[model samples]
Target: MAAAERRASPRRVRTALVALLAAFAVLLTGVSAEAQQRPRTVLEMLFGGGQQAAPERPAVRKPVVRKKKVRATRPARQKKQRTQAARPKPSGQQSAAAAVAAPASKNENAKTVLVAGDFLAASLADGLSNLYADNEMIVIEARTDGSSGLVREDHYDWTEKLGPILDEAKPAVLVMMLGSNDRQPMTVGSRSLASRSEEWVRNYEERIGEITEATKSRGVPLVWVGMPPFKFDRMSEDMVFLNDLYRKGASSVSGEYVDIWDGFVDADGAFVYSGPGVNGQTTQLRNSDGITMTNAGEDKLAFFAERAINRLLGTTLAATGALILGPDQLPTIQLPPIGNAANALQAAPVSIDDPSLDGPDMLLGTGSAGGFSLEPSPRERLVINGGGTGGTEGRADNFAWSEKSAAVTPSGPPIVSRGSLNLQSVRESGGLKPPEEMPTILDAIIEDWSRENEAARPE
Candidate 1:
């Protein structure tokens, strides 16, 4: 009988065991099949029809065709298998070459700087290096002050001099402060100097036009700091004329015209040192000098240059630096051992733990008084027991003075109620409301103070 049972449909029992095991495994996981949120595979999500193995197409039923939803796949992100046929495969060399040839964008702060001038330019270049050393900017300034790089003359090798600086620096701004020693007559290559100042002006215009062309081609904005009148004797006339020529040239360029000349020039525009002509700051606002400027003169000129730089850059140069010598580093300026001005420099830190701090500038107080010993201004305050009559836990509150009160003290007896006391003439102002013959608590306090004062008096 056992053998016959074994042969009787063992496949049925095996099928039942698989179903029971599958159900038991699902149950042990502690989530019902309906409660589980199994994420569909990408292909199943898009194409659908992935349920219960493929159902056989029955001959008795009509054919079912399901349209697939089109998904927007990024062409650049096609899988490797798709890439195998969808696009041309490039060699490693080709990818790198393409990357190298791509156009790149530049930001302002990342651009280089081309500074052109004499030794002053060199110092500026150095200062800038130290100034922007921590920043990201390149600077180039010539060390030579022997010749001015004016439009033309013996030292007309600007392309050799300034050209290389511009090329290497690849500057977005051309900072030029020139004509300090350009007394040699202006010329066009090998041509003669302009006859009259008017012709000289026209010829100067043409030469400047060339310089502007060179600058514009490089996509650099020119910032021309024009010459200040020289501050010496002898060749003052030639120097003054040269300055005017510089002014005209500066105006000709599309760049900003930094009128540093005015910072040094006299009202008449001639060079002088004293009297009505010298305008070198200390020299008064009267005259222009051959060369040099006072500290004030230099400051004004520097300010002019700073403004032009700001305008060209479309914002402040964005200097982020500590002063070379901060007040903290230097001896705190020894204010005169006495002066009201001493108050101007700093504000002493103060915290208001003692509320009486808001009292009269100069005050008299007993050991029991909580208000300050002195105050700059008389301030009114409310006190429940601070008047010495209220509860022991007196509250001091800032309050406005009552207008009706006739008398007041700078700091008064603890104010028990809302009322005004004249900051001045308190004894006379706060006299008792006279009665026929009775006395009040105010009377008692007064009597006590009087007795104390009498006892303290000399025997």
Candidate 2:
């Protein structure tokens, strides 16, 4: 019995030791997991590759250098992105923040002008607006779409809306481009600006006068964009007429006519979208349908335009890839054309007070003789007037009539709109398919082309 009790005591001691070891092991595991949840530097993350242990400091440096370039190549937009990366990038969007912090500008920088049209304007507006890189000199906002006839109430009264901003900004430079959507006709004088382009010519002259006067009032320098060519499929001939008007009219203003088309225009005013290829084969600069640009296209445009503006502002930026020193953008590796310097600008386009009740391209809808018409309405000539969208989902119809909308035509009235077609019974009826994101090739082509092409010309 004594032997047995003695053995039992020792056994109890061993069991306790085992239990304590188990508890200690569990505690150690808990501690290990807690450490993992804490923040780590790039150094701490280096041990992930089946690494049983962390390497010393000197060992990490070389690997990071090699990996960085490789990882950066994952994106193709590195040209512009590199500049951004060089800046102390804050957590979210740096573009919006940069514009907000940019101080007000003064001097020729304000007057030194560059202008772009629609899609290009949108790109520039978001991409290169008020960068604060150029000291108190450069200011540009190009966001007018030509497809919408730029009348007083055109596209949210852009001229009116921009009036206060322009006045307050007191720009010395003004660049203008528009007239793509002037396909339809309206009356400016007692005459119609319709299929009879001669009438349109007079109206165009009068309208341009209004714009030039506005710029003069503000003492802004002016650069005017002439129309570029569209693809042969959609607007080959019509574009020529309009482009010609742009050339003649732009010349009339005594404004610097930067014929965006001429530099890129072919003998037939055709636009090729690319630089020369390796072989003698000619590569196109624009995309397949001829309006939107590829990457190289934008690169050339940005390079030239930025250089022009940079020179106008008299910043010490080299159009060649020269890195900037203190308070300057890096050197641009671009070659821009040096033309005769622009003349001093005068005033802004002033509103003319004619008793005429005409918009740039307002239509009186005659009932449908509809064969391939751009007419958006049947009963009343669709007034393709521009205004606020006012939270309407399918509000475009209120602006212009689109026969292309997926809305079902009512057999009853000839006066239907795009928004109405989208919002109506055929849409809401049972078993009807919901709207799809499908855009036809033509539609896609036009939309894409217009955006890129428009970027070169804004209202």
**13-88 per-residue lDDT for model 2 (tens digits):** 9999999999999997886666555566666677552223445567454443444444432224422222423466
**How many clashes in each structure?**
23, 49
For model 2, the superposed segments whose C-alpha errors exceed 4 Å read 1-117, 123-139, 145-147, 151-162, 187-192, 248-253, 262-269, 276-284, 303-459
Where is model 1 more than 4 Å wrong at Cα?
1-109, 119-145, 159-161, 186-191, 194-200, 233-253, 265-301, 321-459
Q: Name the best candidate (by TM-score).
A: 2
The TM-scores, one per candidate, come to 0.36, 0.40
RMSD of each: 34.3, 39.1
lDDT of 1 by residue, 1-459 (tens): 988878876887998999999999978565533334455577876787333243677779668899898986423311112112334446653443322222122234564556677543443344444333333232233333535556444665454566556777677678776555554456665666643356566765565566666777777888766655555544555646655665665666567766655544458876545432223335442224334443334334445565565456544443432223455867855433333321233576777776658775554574432333322222222243234222322224324344323444446455555658543455667865576786899998999999999999998
lDDT agreement of model 1 with the native: 0.52
Residue 11 accuracy (lDDT) in model 1: 82
